[model samples]
Structure formats: structure tokens, C-alpha cells
Target chain A: MKKILIITFACLISIGSFAQGNVITKHFADYQQDQSFTKVNVSSKMFSLFTEIDGEDETEKAVLDAMSKLKGVKAVVSDSGTDGAKFYREALSRVQKDGSYEELMSIQDKEEEIMFMVRNDGDIIAELFMIIRGADDFVLMTLYGEIDLNQIAKISRILKISGLEEFGKLGGN
Target chain B: MSSRFLIYLFLISSFSGFAQTKLIKTLKEEDKIESSYHLYPSTLRMINLQNDPAFDELIRPVKKLSFSILKPDVYTSKDMHTAYQELLNEGYEEYIEVVNDSASMFVVGNESKSRTCILVNNDEEYYIADLEGMINVLKLGEVYESIANQDTSKIGLGTVFNYVMGENNEKRERAKRRKEREKNGEKEAKKESFQVTIGEEDNEKKDTTSEQVDSLNAIEEKKENE
Candidate 1:
């Protein structure tokens, strides 16, 4: 009877882990068709092409190197007129419920709240997810597959992705 | 029976291609919409004129391009939303989207071969572009920025507008005057007699024409007074 109980508990834990794969991806899909929200998905194929480019400068070389390891990037942004706080709270709760990601840092100011979370593969970071809720905007961006915090911020600046400059604070540059 | 089947297959394939761009077609059919289409060769020639190698290389892969601009007063956000839904129904894969209270833009592609980008801004303007063949969409911003930064004085905007509007009245008038001069064998004499710079010659001609207009007006006023 004791053995059976232990086996059942182990099976339940495995099932729960399997179900909690990626909250951001699932949430992105839900809003892809929503007219009020903006979405961006860059496939690995696009990133693979970046690896072949010969950088003309040091900054370009660093950005290219960081981009090579990325599998994909997905983002969902809400319009300024909408209630950004609601989406931020909902995403925060979902991340907490998943129980797999560890919170790296968080900032709360008078105008905005930002949270950075990561799911690690041993010592290396596998995914870096960021949630930002401003007075007039809400942004959810996820960069998965072998992330380097230092270089990731540079990629956002080079790409001119609107809400991603916040990552610069993490890189301490 | 096989021949009939082949005919039907060909007809279906041709129509499916049109169906893919049905949204653009519908918008084009609307009244008061401004649209333009350009093939690769003409577009390449135009880009070459810019003399920027980076900008030229970026657009080499594009086979064809077409765009339409719509006014927000005629097409509301709700209408744009419906059009977006129709694009999804037509099997376009969403690539990028940016939406805010005042404006929204989205890019969708089909199998990496064709791309459609749509931007709608409330109470302002709306634009759509359909491009064939693959180009790095991310580098587009950089290319445009480089072009925008180029020296504007060298572009000769007045001549470009005249060319686009198909109004070359000044050129035709000058050609006619030159032909008449050549026929009278006065071209060489006139060229030898004119030693002034081009700028000074234009100013001299303008001064003479304005003086003639003022004399004619003075004569008309004196006649009325008499």
C-alpha cells in the first residue's frame, strides 16, 4: 500500500511538470488574434541567417554572437488605452502558478512595474522572460534558448524593440 | 474527360493566387483610395538613382511591390480589424504586430515568399504594402534611415514631382523655342551672344517678362481712365 501511494504521487508530479512548459508562449497564442494587442514572432530560421552575417564593427559582432544561440523571440503588447495593470497581474499570477521559473528582479515605480524571470538549465539560463506594465502600455517579451544577460540588452537596442530597453538595467551598462 | 479535368485544374490554380491577395484587391476597388504598383526592373532603376549601395542591395531580392494608402475618416479601426481577420482567414502567417491607442501595424507573410504589411492609425492615415520575394524585414528600417539621412538638395524634388505628375510643360516649351531658333539658323548666333551665367540668364528673362506684364497693365489702366 505504501509503494502504490508513492508511485501515484510521483506520476502526479511528472504530469504537472509536463503541463507547465511555457506560460508566455501559451499566453502569446491566446492574444495573437486579439485585435487590440500587438504581436511579434521571430522564428529560429530568421536568427540562423543572422549568424552568417559578417559584422563590420565590434558592436555588430557582439550582437550577432548573442543572436546565434537564440531559438525564437515572441512578444505581445497591449494598446495604451487598455488597462495594462490587469494584464500584468494576470501574467504575474500565471508565472507564479507555473512554479518553474525563478524571479531574477522586479521594479515598481509610480508609472510602471517590470518583472524579469528566468528558467535555467543547470547554470546556463534557458529562457529570459520579461513583463512590463506601464500607465498606458503593457508588454510581454520572451527570449528563449541559451540566453546571456549581458549581450541580450544590446540586441534589444540594436533592434530598437520599444519596451526591451529595460533589459539594459540588468546588463548594468 | 482528362482534358476537361486539366482545364478545371488550371483555372483553380490561377484563381487561388488571386484569392491570396483578395484583401488588397478589395481595398483597391474602393473609391478614393490611392495605390501604386511597381515591377522589379523599374524599382531597381529608381533605387540605383539614389546612389546608395547599401539601400540598393537591400531591395535586390524584391520582385514586385504594391502599396495603398487609405484615410482613417473613410476606413475606421473596426473596418481594419475586420480586414485583419480576413487576412488570417486567407492563411497569412503573422510575423510582427505593433498596436497602440492611436496606431496599429502588422506584418504577415505566406511561406516566406510574399509579405503584406498593414498599418492603421485612428483619425489619421492607413497604409498597406504587398511585397513579393523574401528580403530581411528587420534590415528595412536601417535602409530607410540611411536613405532619409541622404542630402536632400541633390534630390531635385521639383523635377521629380514634375516627372511623376507627367507635366513637362517647361521642357516642351524650351524644346519648341530651340527648334525654331535652329530652323532660322539663329542658334549659333544666340549662343555666341549669350555670355551670362545660366542663373543670371534666368533672372534677366524673368525681369523682362515682369516688365512686359507691368507695361500691359499700365496701358489697360490708362485706356480705362481715358
Candidate 2:
């Protein structure tokens, strides 16, 4: 169990360099997406996520899988520990108005440890959801955030990818 | 009521009229919902729950997973006809399922109209090289809620469990469980399963329903495993 968390944590070493400026007009010409930055250097893949927490004690891989498929990502890494003590801090902040809360039975089937790293095209997007579950404990954490979509546009322009501009304008129009 | 008054009324009517509504004109949306979604079935049992015949047909051809690397599951059955018939009801009128072997996969939702899909795989054994490798299945402008909210009701979400159980030679376990149940004279009631999401607002009620629904097979299955 410890080994899994360690490996997942190591993979999450890239998610935090998203603190800056880059904007580009929509590109639909070359079907270009991920037009944000020319180069991406993530700091802490897990910490950079804008996360939400729901209060409950359940454990499973479904939650992890759900977070992995979120967009604006190119990769992800997950691992965790059994630290139910951590839940109090996150749930206070993670609950949302969308009724987006996913629940679990309890910390019963606890194999609790999770970590993830992710990006889109090439920029760090979200590194969400991690927990540590023991036979009687669980810790849940999540992150969500918007990447520099504008930078994605600029990168597409620089690369001169066609159709990206058109795709971008699909909504901006 | 004279011609002059009629002209005045016509002018007023023309001035007061609102722009005619057009299908394309109104849907010209700026804040468009990307409508992206992803699904990660627990395991291969999900195939049985498929309720879509075409999805089953897609699975039928795949006898084995030859190799791994850049692998993804794509269901090519244009016509979904299966015992579980849920896809037809949930708007998967035409779709595909991409199986990246036993551990992972990529699916495109409603291939006919909007592209969407769900993915599932093992993180510890296979996801060694790339951490976010599993997410390659997601497309732009997708929402998980929209797809799963509609699909899981009919087929059931035990696909993941089925997958895990399946990997461990679960058919053997299930058969054994069935025998044990027969020895004990246990009969499964209400063969026609229905998923009724009774309450969303009240937590207690939902919990109560969840508890009541844990049937004997489930209870026995847990005890036998232990």
C-alpha cells in the first residue's frame, strides 16, 4: 500500500506552474487545442488543483477514475495515505452548490491512498483527489482549476496549427 | 375602425413584435456546454450489464488483448442490440466502446451526434510509465455527469466490481456462490431489477433505501468471501 502511494506521489511532481499570463484568440483552423504555453514546467502536480470535498467516508477507485478523465490534462498520477484527520480541513472548503457530492459507504474497505498528476496538450491542468484509507480511516481531497485557455490559443498560433482558431471561435462567436 | 385606424394598428403591431425565434439563431450560444463525459466501468462484468446488444457484439469479436501501448477500446457496433437494452434508452442510439485490454479502455459516447465516453483501468499494474495516460480518452467540452447520470441506471455500475472479480477467475466464485445459495435454499427475489433513485434531498432516506436494497445475495457474497 505504501509503495503505491509513493509511486503515485512521485508521478504528481508536475502540477503547480500554472501561475501566469498567456492568452490567444480561438483557433479553429488547424483544429488546434492546447494553444496556451510554448513550454510547461509544473511544480507540484497534486497541489495545483482547485479541488472540492464532500464529507463522507468511503473508498474506491471509481472516484479516482472520475477525476482522471477531466479535460485540460495530458497526464495524471495518483497515490494516497490513510489519514482521516485530513478530511476535516478539506470538506469545509470542498463542498459545492452543484450538488456534485459523491458519497461512499464508510472507511470500511479502506486501502486508502491516492495521488494524481495531469495536464492538457502540455500544461498542468488539475491534479485532483487523493486520500489515505486504513482499515478504519480515510482521507479525501480534490482540486479543480482553469488553465490558461488563452495561452493555448497563442501556442496554437505560434505553431501555426490550422483550425484551432475556428474551434476557439465556436463559442466566442 | 376606419382604414386610418387599421393602418395605425398595423404599425403598432409591427413595432411591438419581437424577433422571430429560429432554431439555429437561439442555440448560437457563447457559453456552450462542452458536454464532455467519461465512464470507467469497474470490470468486465459491465459487459454483461451492457444491456446493449451491439456493445455485446463488439465484445464478442475481441477474444483476446494482443498487446499493450497506445491501446484504446472502441466499440464499432453501429446498431446496439443486446440483452441489457439500456443504451437505446439512455441515448446511446449509436456509439462505440474502446477496450484497451482488460485493465483499461476509451469509449466515445453517442458517436452519431456528440462524442463522449468513459474510461477505466488499473493504476498500479499498468499505469507505470505515464500517470495521466488514462485520461487520453477524454475529449474537449465533455461532462461526466451528463453521460453517467443517464447510462448507469439501466446496466448497473457493478462493471468495475465485475472487472475486478472477473480478473480473479470470478466465474468460479460466482458458480460456487450459487451452489452454496442453493444448498441453503436461497432464492433471489424480484428478478426484474429496477433502479429507482428515490430521494436526493434527504440523506437519511437515501441511506435507508441503500440499506434495504442490499439483498441476500450481496449479504451472502460478503460473508462467503470473508
| Cα interface RMSD of each candidate | 6.1, 19.9
Q: What is the lDDT of residue A136 in candidate 2?
A: 38
Error of 1 at A98 (Å): 3.2
Off by over 4 Å in 1: A1-21, A25-94, A105-114, A121-124, A133-138, A145-151, B1-22, B26-32, B37-64, B71-91, B100-102, B112-125, B134-226
lDDT of 1 by residue, B1-226 (tens): 1222211111111100111277877776775255343435355447355565654555555555554556444776777778888887877655455554555565555553345444444334555556665443235445444434554334332223324323333444566788897877876666656745666889999999999999999999999999
TM-score of model 2 vs. true structure: 0.18
Give the Cα-based TM-score of candidate 1 against the true structure.
Answer: 0.52
Q: For model 1, what is the alpha-carbon lDDT of residue B222?
A: 100
List ranges where model 2 is wrong by over 4 Å. Answer: A1-76, A82-148, A151-173, B1-143, B148-151, B154-170, B174-226
| lDDT on C-alpha atoms for all candidate structures | 0.62, 0.27
DockQ of each: 0.15, 0.01
Best by DockQ: 1
Cα lDDT of model 1 overall?
A: 0.62
**Chain B TM-score (model 2 vs. true structure):** 0.19
Q: Count clashing residue pairs per candidate.
A: 0, 83
All-Cα superposition RMSD per candidate:
18.7, 29.9
Residue pairs of candidate 1 with colliding backbone atoms: none
